[model samples]
Target: MSERTGWDRRLRVRADGKGLVGHAGVVLLRRCADQVGLTGALAAVLPVGVGHGWRERAAVVVQLAVAIALGAVNLSEAEQLALHHRNLFGPAASDSTTRRTLAALDESALTRMAKARRTVRRHVWSLLHLRPGGFPWLSVAGRRLKGWIVVDMDATVITAASKKERAAATF
Candidate 1:
């Protein structure tokens, strides 16, 4: 079929009981996350009954992941997703709530969380039919070579808009 361009079709608004979803794609991604057993894994790792009214660990992690995937630079930006479907998406977590949740986690909790994350990663990789081994071969300048991936993590200087404890010129 030939591709059609421009606004050939007219747009209309339907005021039905159906709600509008801003990050609709994220909902699909959440389903995939659920399929990969992320929720159960996170529940096993994270502390229980810690959040009085705060969202659960699995929900918070998925929400944060969705926000990050949608190009949210900070935790406060999660409100953008929550605003569209507050009822369907569950309770919206404030920036302070997210911060406090992370801060309250001890070393043991952190370790468990990491292990759970690793399990989720492995499950996702398996679902995508990706093998765990050496890097795939890449063609460069018409020559095939086993590609090697390198990651560099370095601290950079940034000016904070507000005063923060231990805030320095560089991290």
Candidate 2:
């Protein structure tokens, strides 16, 4: 019998060695964990006590994963990519599981996380040690030139849609 085998190219994990860190999957997992609580992540479910009912948090991650993959519409297709690349269990999520999980969230945890993130951006500016215009978005032209920063808003692609209509408002 030959000493070598076809499995030589296969990757193997070291049971006693350290595992991968800072990988995309690990980073995404950390973000999801922050969205829900760490405890919620381990459980992959939680109750917001907001009258919606029990909510499963893993779907939050799966849905985002699907979006990041791009062009994944149905749950099954999303699950396939999630399973192959991220090694997250996709086939385990059926339509019903997804539906119930969604129904369970009063508002999407993902959306809440997004909103919370926006608020957090302003927190840095609130620090006492940082004076006005010291945070860097401000320029040193305060006394010599325009002190205010101009913010431009455009909605060329943003739209508001409802179930009754595909797009209620578009810009």
Candidate 3:
């Protein structure tokens, strides 16, 4: 188990073609969050509930984010994280707890969360800048842009062979 988060870290990966665990990618995602200090940063900014048996708010938020990344559409679905992955995930917050945590976030709290995210982003970029090649450059239309991160949020449309109810032919 990890000393910082108390999550199990005994997972082993092998190509022996035996004892496969599905959705193991979540472990890597969780580790990345921990290594990047995102979990600690969010915990420092968020309010910790007063009383025993209360899980860390930041942990719950991170778990929910991971659940979403794993295709969970709602808080109830987030419970899937604890269903079969208890050993890997430790104790996950209940859906009601998640709802309450989200509901308790006011404007100020949201601002703090945003600031925390920005801080982490800056830290990560600084680390990237220290790499051998420095920050990566982007080339578009024969124009090379350095020291700038370009995010493309273009929407993609996929055509379906057969149309179904409430399903668009192309999306």
Best by lDDT: 3
Per-residue C-alpha lDDT of model 1 across residues 20-136, encoded as one tens digit per residue: 455556655665676688878987787667436856866677777777888888878876665554645557777776777778788998888889889898876565455565434
Q: Give, for candidate 1, the lowest lDDT window spanning 10 residues.
A: 2-11
Off by over 4 Å in 1: 1-17, 50-54, 127-171
Each prediction's whole-model lDDT (CA): 0.65, 0.45, 0.79
lDDT of 2 by residue, 1-171 (tens): 221231222223456744322233433443433443443342333433234433345544445454445566776665544444433222334445565665765656656655544554455335523676553343454543434543334423556556674556544
**Candidate scoring better on lDDT of 1 and 2:** 1
Q: Could you arrange the candidates by TM-score from highest to lowest?
A: 3, 1, 2
Clashing pairs in 1: none
User: What lDDT does candidate 2 reach at residue 116?
Assistant: 49
Question: Residue 87: error of model 1 in Å?
Answer: 3.5
lDDT per residue, candidate 3, 65-85, as tens digits?
A: 888999999988898664556
Cα distance off (Å), candidate 1, residue 44:
1.1
Candidate 3's displacement at residue 45, Å, is: 0.9
The model with the greater TM-score, 1 or 2, is: 1
Q: Give the TM-score of candidate 3.
A: 0.70
What local lDDT does model 3 show for residue 159?
A: 65
